[model samples]
Target: MGLLFSKFSSYLFPNIECRTLMLGLDGAGKTTILYKLKLNETVNTIPTIGFNVETVTFHKLTLTVWDVGGQERIRPLWKYYFPNTTTLVFVVDSSDIERFSDAKEELFSLLGEPELANAQLLVFANKQDMPNAKNPAELTEILDLGSIKNREWFICGTNAHTGQGLYEGLMWVKKQMKA
Candidate 1:
């Protein structure tokens, strides 16, 4: 998937390289946001392996966003991309309170690394349109993002399947990088 980016890196996305890293487990809407940024036609969800990279040009900044696998078995690979990331976005399934702790732990461990000390963190409380989904404040209380330095974070309720909240999320990432 990223082969195209490598080919076009010279002419297309000329300046940026350290892209935003996005990680969450399966059914967390990572891929959906990927497609939304790509202006892709949303269809059946495809399972990601180690990860997938998508490139989008927002004005002069060409964002090479990496979507890491969120499934339990594939999580170890998440560390590989975390170090050089310009920003880290942790997407949470707001409806799943039972698994919130697991998500928090994974995110904490990732952000704890010295390499990521300066990275911006953005949390997407996704699937907000769902009937059972909880709000951003509830998710924020569970994640406790206040401690992190460069602590710019947003809790945007999103329905990735419909392309809502995707732009706001992307724009937030851009803002973090600029700041």
Candidate 2:
């Protein structure tokens, strides 16, 4: 009887709506991750010029994801998309150690924004399948995630090419939304 009630409740409330913003440096695989989450398969992607919005359903959640371009020139445009964001998914190129500083700078800048004060942050240490990819712990230290005390945050290693860890990241975001 309990199992039946749970199923019935889920059927009645099928989807929790979430607005997610995906941000990162140009080669951090934000577009790739977005397509992987939406299509469940890899797709050839060019650098996003402005942004791409997509709706993806994971279990009982319907996520409206806004993937913004992360080039240096486009960084100024990111704030415009931050107003109603429920979750911020920041992708990082785990294999690119030289650019870690740049990524860190942008991430910190975003965190300082007043508009994102209430947003949950999910940082993806992306490209984990690459031979030189950094792990999640290293990324946490490099990104200074440990010092963050204002809002909910999580970090996960992900390989967008094979979809490993993508769902786990989304699940974390779902849990944050519930909290």
Point to the candidate with the largest lDDT. Answer: 2
What shift in Å separates residue 40 of candidate 2 from its native position after superposition? 0.7
Cα misplacement distance, residue 161 of candidate 2 (Å): 0.8
For 46-71, candidate 2 gives per-residue lDDT tens digits of 98999999999998888999999999
Quickly count the clashes in candidate 2. Answer: 0
Per-prediction TM-score: 0.83, 0.93
Q: Model 2: how far is 106 from its true place, Å?
A: 0.5
Candidate 1: stretches off by over 4 Å? 1-18
Tens-digit lDDT string for candidate 1 (1-179)? 58877878757645544478888867788888877767746756688877778887765567788998898998976778866777777889888878888988988888777777777787889989887788887787878776655556677777788877777877777666656
* lDDT value, residue 117 of candidate 1: 75
* Model 2 TM-score on a 0 to 1 scale: 0.93
